[model samples]
Target: MEEAALLIDPEEIAALYRELCQFPSLSSACIGPEVTTQYGGKYCNIYTEWSQRDLERAENVKFCRQYLIFHDSQSIVFSSPSGNCTEIKGELLSRDSPSGAQKAVLRKITNSKGEEKQFLEVWEKSRKVKSIELTALEKHGQVYEDDQFGCLAWSHSETHLLYVAEKKRPKAESFFKPKAPELSNEEELTKAERRDKAVKGEQFVFYEDWGETLVSKSVPVLCVLDIESNNVSVLEGVPDHISPGQAFWTPGDTGVVFTGWWHEPFRLGLRHCTQRRSALFYVDLTGGRCELLTGDTKAIWSPRLSPDQCRIVYLENQASGPHQQCSRLCMYDWYTKLTSVIVDVVPRQSQGEFTGIYSTTLPERCWAADSQRVVLDTAQRSRQELIVIDTLSGSVCSLTKGCPLGSWAILTVDRDLLVARFSTPNCPPKLMVAFLPPAGKETEINWVCLEEASPIQGITWDVRTFQPPPEQINPQYEGLDFEAILLRPTQIPQTGKIPLVVTPHGGPHSVFTTSWTLYPAVLCRMGFAVLLVNYRGSLGFGQDCVDCLPGNVGSQDVKDVQVCVQNVLEEDPLNPQRVALLGGSHGGFLSCHLIGQYPETYKACVVRNPVVNIASMVGSTDIPDWCLTEAGLEYDQAALPDPAQWTKMLLHSPMQYVDKVQAPVLLMIGEDDRRVPPKQGLEYYHALKARGVPARMLWYPGNNHALSGVEAESDGFMNIALWLIKHLK
Candidate 1:
């Protein structure tokens, strides 16, 4: 096993990363061609890959915005407006601003070496599209990722453009600083030497979800552009504390409505910032001033003005409790200065066939043309469902009933028609369209499947949901439970008992549903039965069930998983000894605990970015509330860093059973992970080594908590496959 581990090529990990990236990813329908690409009468829309932007930048310095049809899915054949078959490729542009004159840039990229063709393109509609580089201050200290044209917007007149860009922070001399070497010195420093030469303290500059690549790269700042004059200026007056995005033009286009964070410094870096405080604020285009719309209170996001421009609707959570709380549907009246709760509570179960309000925050533009109703995706019984909420009558209606079992998310919506990205347990992501029927005609709306993003074949799935007996559930969580999903090869193994891979999801708050996922698919292909334990504390089971994990972490949640696993093994021809475990973050916390608490039960374990010592992590992590609340301690912005809290945290931490772990483990960590710092993994790794337990660890540089840099995630998955083969197989 050591020899084989040594032989694993570092490049193969990158190859797998690219291979995974090539897998069909279905993004929301920001915009799609209602007519075929052949009808390119005026707006010749064309989409290209962003990674390939360097190619055109290096080779073709100048290009014209001529073509109109482009997208990121498959090279699809569709009828053009001219009645001819046309191919649409790259990602579809946002239809929200299609009425204006914009500048579009197109670039082509080679995806997965040769497996797929992808192009990165942006639309530039103005007559003369120009580019102006920024000054040191104009860059405004913001890193703008390809978050679907983030921080980029056009005014109502299409004359002024608004965007947020990254600006470099001035370097500061540190107190524990080392003297800088002369640049003209005898020898040049290697990259590693220069990196090591930089002096830094342990204090984090900002609390970011993913700590490394972005935080270090740049800060976010709002910018304005004059299209005809070819000039740019950084907007001022808005406080630097907030990181705002998803800007929308107000009624008169005189101001902007956007979402930004408002929290203490300790709450900065958490991935789930919504758990703290988020609000919709309006920014004056002229004065550059900003003001909070939702007041200084509960979390609110994704604010949208009614089509009539008189009313507004946004997602609101009234209570500031668990990170995974339910969203309340809020409505605002511009004239009356009154806000109403259109839907205050998520019905524990469907009222009549009407599932509860869509749980997650909506992306931009989910409103109907009449602006009377809104649509969003919801989680009910582990199924991704689509529903419409009528603002005036507070009526809830179901849109998807007979479609294949899967998940559906909004891509683009206009008037009553919506294009959604659909994924079933059986196949890859596909573009689907649905219409909102007036009031009573819910069943008349049909969800039609259209072009696939990237058609992935050979891989198939057999997934089912299991309800662990209520009697078998942890007594404390009895009657308050969620189901576990079991997936395997459609054809049962004929020989030895098939190995079982038990996966616990991160976000003890997050749920594992009957959706298509790559990890489980990979394991199933490797000839293992995979069971995803939603257990308690997961979503879709209602807020009461989700709130159960606070003080019960490491105990109740672990028991739920163990019982779920035992129930599955008894019902199937699965091996009881060769059980393999996989998880990340909270899931990893459970994995470490599972291996130690049940030392003789499992064969191997794989953990990525795990939390081993909550006491230590409470200080280093961005979300201190996670450690506090999960330990059953009532979290306060000020009353923490206490010894009483440490006792509870240590009790819940996996570190308590560090000496009993028997299963050989593989640890994958992101060097820049802020969520569960890399030290947590290192501590666990060294403990395993000291105990003489077989262990291996890998660290990906510059990756954040997710370790999702294409090559890094790929490397982690490939090594997991190799490691599992040596142990579980």
Candidate 2:
């Protein structure tokens, strides 16, 4: 491994990063795929948006407009959809009418003088556009853009629009400030007089918001816009304790149904946390009355209505336990007002059996033409597979079964035709369309490729499952096993064994699917084998697997990763002596633990926003509940930890074993990250430096926990490659 690292050129690594940036990733596909008569012939219309790196802007730019994808003589052709307009600037949210006759777009436009203004535009099918400037008084505050509390929806009649925004409040002012002079005429009062009447001394008040990625979003209120009258009004009677979002029109357009999150006790980090207490609610427009549609004890998400509007289907999970778990698919009958579980949570599963639904949310339009079958994507071990569930028969079938694609996701379902995106570790995402097969024949889908697969050269991948010996397995998780995807260069060096990089995903709850990920592929292209590990606690392996790591974090998860690496070394022709570690968040936590517990096993380590000391992090991180819960203790915001609890937390932290670390370390930190604060990395960096161990830290100013800004990611990856090359030797 040292010989191979010594032979690599730095210029080659930089070139590989630049080349990989050119590949566009699929951002989102528009729901309700259309079949129009004017677009050449009778062809399925698939619209998808893509995102790519913009090196000039130091950001990732999304092309939010639609692309027309159609089949033509054994090949797929891409073009612009009919009536597609030029992509708007600073567009925050957009929605189309049910009939596709009109479109509503929300944009934040800045004038030449640098004054920012919000505008709402309505475009008609006949090329007529109505643009309305929204003043601060009318909009209340900036629109919610994050997924947890943002919503923009059109009424069935298309005459009104409903969205979620910050609640209106009086501007804060100083209590002891001077009063404005009286104007001669009451009607000609100056601006200072108006400001004097506003509430005072509230600027410093701290209002808790939904944590992490959701910032400055404390109080979200539903607002409706009368398109014809050009008036906006906040919906009433939504209960002052809850924040509402994901709203849509009811069956008769007389009410709105949405998800309401309780903010009574406090708000925890909501992004990627499905266990937050939330429930379905219906608010009647005429009387301003609110009613609970689902019980308040469980978390619910994405209540998709059936095509016939007779029933609604949603996902439910435990409200306060694991952040991610096996969700139960539930349906609520509109007429009967009764909810039933269509698919219950599976505690455990045998090999190749249906584990359970492990998806955060379902697609906007997932119901089949018959309205009894629903199509959604879910994690099934090491891959993401598209599955269809029969609401009546309670039967589930995999639509992408027997297919080689490592990941499958539904884009939209138009009538019986389903549009989906699928990819493998070596292949980029491609579009495919398939007609829904009849019941019990879901696996026999004759898919028509809308786009050809673009496989990256010099990279090959295979999925490997690892199981511990009976004595080594945790007794509580007897049947538990883990999996890893090994990506290697197609042409290995003939002289030396290939160096290995063991990469674990961030969410201990998250699984590393055998999908096409850019960074891992880049490492393989650089002549390194990358092992993406999905440990015992990862999702898609049943609730038992997910529950295995919470009480046993820092030890069980660490051992599982070690077991995977050892098994891979025994089975494959990889150098065990040249092993390195790369991970972020909890994965980083595991990486830190590995180096300390088994210091001599790894040659180098790179951690991004790692959790170094849980005892210290519990007081600073956005999700304090995570610290206590993962440490096998119940979290109470009001109860402070005693010395005994602190000692236990410290025992599980990587800082306790810092003295045992042998590998040279590289710390990549996002300064503005809220999930795992930057101080976590700083503590580790300082500790290693004090001990005379080689260590380095790179801090990105505006990036978040993911360090996902295009420019930041590019520079970080380049630095990572260089650091690994320099130290592995």
Candidate 3:
């Protein structure tokens, strides 16, 4: 079969490229606002739409977006200030904004018997002197004599005002402080001199000029406000020892409540420390007494009572370690007053550390009803698997057949598991939902067709063919097979051929997928073919491939890309006489080495934030200490063979070979980057200048390593397109 020749014009190709660049990359829309998570249902679940500009600044920002709340198939909870307030059974509450300005709205319904219930609008607006008031259905009351206070939760029964009161120490009292004696060697006084005088004072000092207030004592109380008589009584003792954290009553609307708390000194240095401990304490409404059910050692998070109220299930840290363990499902029985671990498994762990070598792989966690069973997703080296655990029986079952390529491939809600399955990098991922039955054959799973999620835009791509002189259509490799996607330019003359752009992805650990891209289309539109290689160590190929990424295996990635480019050039003699290699970050590092190791292979190069010096990169990144620990290497040059091996790094550094780079180069960086700091880019730029090489540096002032901010992201892609046009010209 003869293939049709591509028709392309340089002007038309550039026009389409520009239009595509303006299109948004990817964005997520809710499955109609709120989806079911727990009682009252969880709100945000975004299903991504790909046509949106990923570079848009506001897209990442979370704001006051309206979501629908479903009460039943027939009735729904709509949040609208314009519509009349309706009444229904069960308590309805508005999610509060972080500012704490407007009081969160709540609607309480006793029954579904009638559509009409008494309308009420009770909220507290801030003013100079503060007072709390409640008015509903001709019933009203005022209760407060405090400077300021905030609402936590209004009683569902409308009997109490659960709130927190704050008071600051007087400026005059806090300003008076003891002076410290200066250390003097000439005058040695009493035992205090030999033992070093210890200063005693409050941790913070208040200054009139600074508008700072010292905190001496803070107390929180649950109060009952008499709606009829207009009287207020403090439910907790006046000089309360308890500092409530979260005080939400149980499911049955019982007088007994749960309050989260931690001891003060134990919480010391804790405000700055990432580790936190929160435990639930039982408080009595009728009797002004509170009993601590659990100590501060255990972390009680997201506590919820069962429908029967007999058992409470919560995610918490059950292990005895300085660092909190990945959360596990724990159950506390009301009757037994005993807390037991229902399911123990690692929740997600931080990236960078692939195995338990230095850090454990954080597993994905999901719990079944009564915490009897759990789904665990664990990743190692590079492979990931889904395991079902019968916590009670200590039995485990495998759910998916192949390992997950990346962490985003699996998700769980309640007992239902959603797995993203893809056979290869070129194939799109399919979403599969399944119910893991207890003992018998696992229920058959069905994949949700996501073709609607297509026309997925914002992918940068280049696709060129490799015709290997007609002698070989395919090449064989021992470890992995090669795959390719070729795009014939739309208007190039059939008498001749086109150029090839070889682009490598940034993260040595990341990959180029059929997931869609923005750059290659621009290249193809510009009358050139592109070859996107999902080389070894690229994600979506399972754990084994990922594990092969480290230890300078990037050479394999380079080999794959170079072979594809060479094969393409062999088929078309009218094709480009010169090939250009380009990438950012780790990819930039590879590009730098390519020009040094195989100088003749590429005609020119553009590198952004390249790691010219690996040892230097390790020492300068945000988590230098963590990186050192993970890479198992010292900062000193002796770590590499022949301490002068640092010279290989220097020789291969793009900066060192600026004069040797016969090709034009464009370098870029974000000034605020902590990872592969801007210095790396600047260093190369200066070197190119010294060598009088045809090079230019483009910089964004306050951008991070990824160029994440709105302006930075936009500038990044735009600069790349412009740079390519200059080189192609």
**Whole-model lDDT values for every prediction:** 0.65, 0.83, 0.46
Q: Please identify which of the two predictions, 1 or 3, would achieve the higher TM-score against the true structure.
A: 1
Models ranked on TM-score: 2, 1, 3
Better of 2 and 3 by TM-score: 2
Candidate 1's residue-wise lDDT over 203-309, tens digit each? 44653432323353334556666667766676665667676665667777788777666533533443454465767777887888887776657777667777677
Q: Which stretch of 10 consecutive residues in model 2 shows the poorest summed lDDT?
A: 71-80
TM-score of 3: 0.50
| Alpha-carbon RMSD of each model | 8.5, 2.9, 14.6
Which regions of candidate 2 deviate over 4 angstroms? 1-7, 31-44, 64-88, 126-128, 137-139, 184-196
TM-score of each: 0.80, 0.95, 0.50
Better model by lDDT: candidate 2 vs candidate 3: 2
Displacement of the residue 586 alpha carbon in candidate 1, Å: 0.9
Which digits, one per residue and each the tens of the lDDT, describe model 2 over residues 632-663? 87888789888988887888898999999989
Q: Cα lDDT of model 2 overall?
A: 0.83
Q: Clash totals for all models, in order?
A: 44, 0, 30
Error of 3 at 649 (Å): 6.0
Report the lDDT of model 1 for residue 344.
70
